[model samples]
Target chain A: MSTTVDRPLRADARRNREKVLDAARGAFAETGLHAQIEDIARRAGVGVGTVYRHFPTKDALVAALAEAHFAHLADIVEAGARREGDAWEVFAATILDSAAPTAGDAALCEIIAGHPQAIEAAALGQERLKAATGALMGAAQRAGQMRDDATVQDVQAIMCGFGQVAAAQRAGAQMDWQRYLTIALDGLRAR
Target chain B: MSTTVDRPLRADARRNREKVLDAARGAFAETGLHAQIEDIARRAGVGVGTVYRHFPTKDALVAALAEAHFAHLADIVEAGARREGDAWEVFAATILDSAAPTAGDAALCEIIAGHPQAIEAAALGQERLKAATGALMGAAQRAGQMRDDATVQDVQAIMCGFGQVAAAQRAGAQMDWQRYLTIALDGLRAR
Candidate 1:
């Protein structure tokens, strides 16, 4: 939905919007949601007014960021869902692939988790991400590839917890995210 | 060592020490490490001097609390080590049992994670806990019960991550810790 939003903007306006999104992505990746909007505008080489006019609220900008990631995740999920092999294998790949991007950036993870104190535009991103994950997980459960007891929320919380672990790992905590992810995947299998 | 710290003290002095520990535990459990020394003393019905005399710093008090947890965890690990059956089973029991306690409390998990900005006393507790866990895991690995690639730190990180999932679940996230723990255990098993 976000990617298709178009109202026939001026050429300069479109360029400015693209610049703001790029700057915001880099800024959020570096310092998370706490990166000041002024810094993002400066990095974009645009006036703060230009940035604000493009996205009226910080959350709206965050939603834009989230929109990008979730869209990528959705693409991955759709691919996984389309796979012909074992449902569990497909689901496992989906989980690992879906989380890989957000786990690499604390800011991205923060935006994805929808920290109640931050990211006002989280609802749409949350919904989209939820649907993608659900589709994959639901397929697995229906095929008896995953534990019947497993819920989409369970996968989400595990993903979020790992995101924190990624941040901790960056902070010098020794951990291997992939190894742990494999373990989580194994755990999701039907008993 | 902390539990048996020997010193001559008047009965009221002993009472004050116990009271301070109680109040500090409650405060930290409720509000995390940010709970103030002044508040702890007031809650304990003791003078600030009494609290200060017992714990010269918040880190010291936090260390004392951490000491209790590690001691409990050590007991679990030692019990697992003493078990006669499969090493992995004993070790898994120990991991889940140990995490079950602190996972129920937010402050305890924060203390365990050794947040860079908080809980400075965590190092000693971490060291003790690590040593105990290492002994159990090392035995399991030596006996070919667990995957050789697994390390004590890996297990610790997973356990801490689960502590987070527990918190998230409390906040209404859907997840089954035991099920996930099973996956981690399976991952640790020898192929």
Candidate 2:
């Protein structure tokens, strides 16, 4: 076995790994899952071999990136849940934050919608986000911020709709997802 | 020139034409714009040559089908506008009825969204639908049923979103578009 495989990653190696992930994230955010690994390597100032060694495959890299983003979203939603304010504001704000970034990300939105059967790890990440969303929704309903009948499924449908709207906006339809989401959120509010 | 081109369509010829259009409508509604002309002819129990005679190309057939649907939607919106009821109810009902069918028809939704630059006739049909929708929305706003801040653009965005939700629902995700639209419409209502 190569000594490089046996030894722990040194500081420079770790730095290179982080750089590659960062480059991949930026590339994917800009160009979606179709972002080329060679381009990502060039952006990271690393060799294509280095990227392949770390990721092994494109799906692996994509799944890793998707998991991280989903986890980040869950973190954001959970943080919002703990914030001191109207429950609905926390809810709406979190959604707006996600929608704005995701509007340009076709790959991430596909993962969110669970279309074409996402990878197991990415699907797990989505499940985590869904659970976190459910908690926030339940908290809002209990606080009388959201209507009693509102379900996480309804929120999922709305989020998927808003994601497409964001895409439509990107595709030259001039419309505000934030305003439309607010309207839906208002509908979710308890009387 | 072929004699058939100059002669008035006998009853049988007219019936065949209607059959081809009907078959095209059903196939497109079921399988979208990708619905094959041969499949449409087979479904109509007519020969493929018959389909070709009536519709010179798939785009022409698809465009005609989209125009007819748009015209039908425009009529529905206009009829709703004339109906005796609360303006908001009229508006909401019209949206729900349109969404239910459109949710299943992806190609029509794409045309409605003006994606890939829809045919001129399909675009014209959409314009008529928008005018009718505008009339209903204006009536609702004037009657103090909907918010003054709400614009026809908002309605279009919502319709686009709902049409997507309907599509999503068809693709194995169980969702109640009516309930969600109710929430969205509630958000549209004047305070």
Candidate 3:
């Protein structure tokens, strides 16, 4: 029988892992998936070999980074769910905040899109995200804070539109997602 | 001074003009400015010489077609402004309907983008479009059906987003622009 190694990473190893993720996040946000892994390692102040030792492959590194970002977003959604006040307000607040890409999520998307395996992993993450969003939407509807006629699909569309606008803005193009959002929402309000 | 042509075109000339415009609209839509004028004349069941007789240059043809289309859109916008009841509802209806390419506007865009001189003429048409859209939006705000905070810029963004979704639909891709529009508008409503 082969024995499995169960040893923990050393302190230096852990620090290197954190640094690599941070650097990768920044690089992806600035230039997209084409950003080089060696550059990320250099920015992280780690050797290329050290980054490989820690992450195995660029895709693996990106998938791990993406997981962490989604976990952070899930935390925000959970926090909003637990907030006191109308459930609709909580859901709306969370949705609005999440509309813009954080440096991490954008990088994760750029990184993962190149790797088929990472794309599958991201799909799983997206499913988990949908469930979290659905919960918030349901609570709002139940509390009469939001119009019952509105569906989870409606919320997802807003998120997508907002993300597209934010992406354009990141590219130094000005596009407003807010005012149209206001006018559309007025149409959806319960009479 | 040359007398403005006092006589209307004879029956055969009028028939040729209509045939040419229809063919030009379709050819422009399919192939933009690269669509050969000879091909357009063939499609119109006329000679290349006849096409030249009716339209002195590609810009002349494109400008005439664009002028007619923009004038029609302007009429719609004006009608919406004069609507007595809910301005918001009418405004939304008009935008949603017009956002999709009619068989005509797509041809105009294709021709304008295909030819440099036509592009300049198209710019003039766009200026007219913006003026009409601004007037309609102003009316909606004055009636308090739309949020006072909404700007013409925001409306333009919504139109752009809708256009993207419409283009996707045209290519047989499904995207829920309608749902997105609803959620976005709900978010914008004065709550």
For model 2 chain A, where is the 10-residue window of minimal lDDT? Answer: A110-119
N/CA/C clash count, model 2:
0
Q: Is candidate 1 or 2 superior in lDDT?
A: 2
Q: Between candidates 2 and 3, name the one with more favorable TM-score.
A: 2
The sequence of per-residue lDDT tens digits that candidate 3 reaches over residues A1-191 is 54987688999998998999889888877766667988998999988998899888887877776676666666676667667877756776776565434522445433321223553556655666667787887887777666787766565444434434444444443454444444444444554
Q: Give the proportion of true interface contacts each model preserves, from 0 to 1.
A: 0.40, 0.58, 0.36
Assess every candidate by TM-score. Answer: 0.76, 0.79, 0.61
C-alpha lDDT values of all predictions: 0.74, 0.76, 0.62
Better of 1 and 2 by DockQ: 2
Rank candidates, DockQ, best first. Answer: 2, 1, 3
Over 4 Å off, model 1: A1-21, A33-64, A111-121, A138-145, B1-20, B33-42, B45-64, B113-120, B138-145
Report the lDDT of model 1 for residue A21: 95
| Model 1, span B1-191: residue lDDT tens | 57987779989989999999999889887776679999999999988898989888887888888777767766776666677777777788888887788776667766554365443444565666778788788888999977788888678667756766665555455566666566656667776
All candidates: TM-score of chain A? 0.83, 0.80, 0.76
Model 3 TM-score (2 dp): 0.61
Per-residue lDDT tens digits for candidate 3, residues B1-191, read 76786688989999999999999988877765568999999999999999999899877987887777656665666666666767667777666555444423444433321223443565765666678677767777787666677766676555544433333334333346665554554333344
Write model 2 residue lDDT over A151-191, tens digit each, in one string. 88888778766766765666668788788888877778887
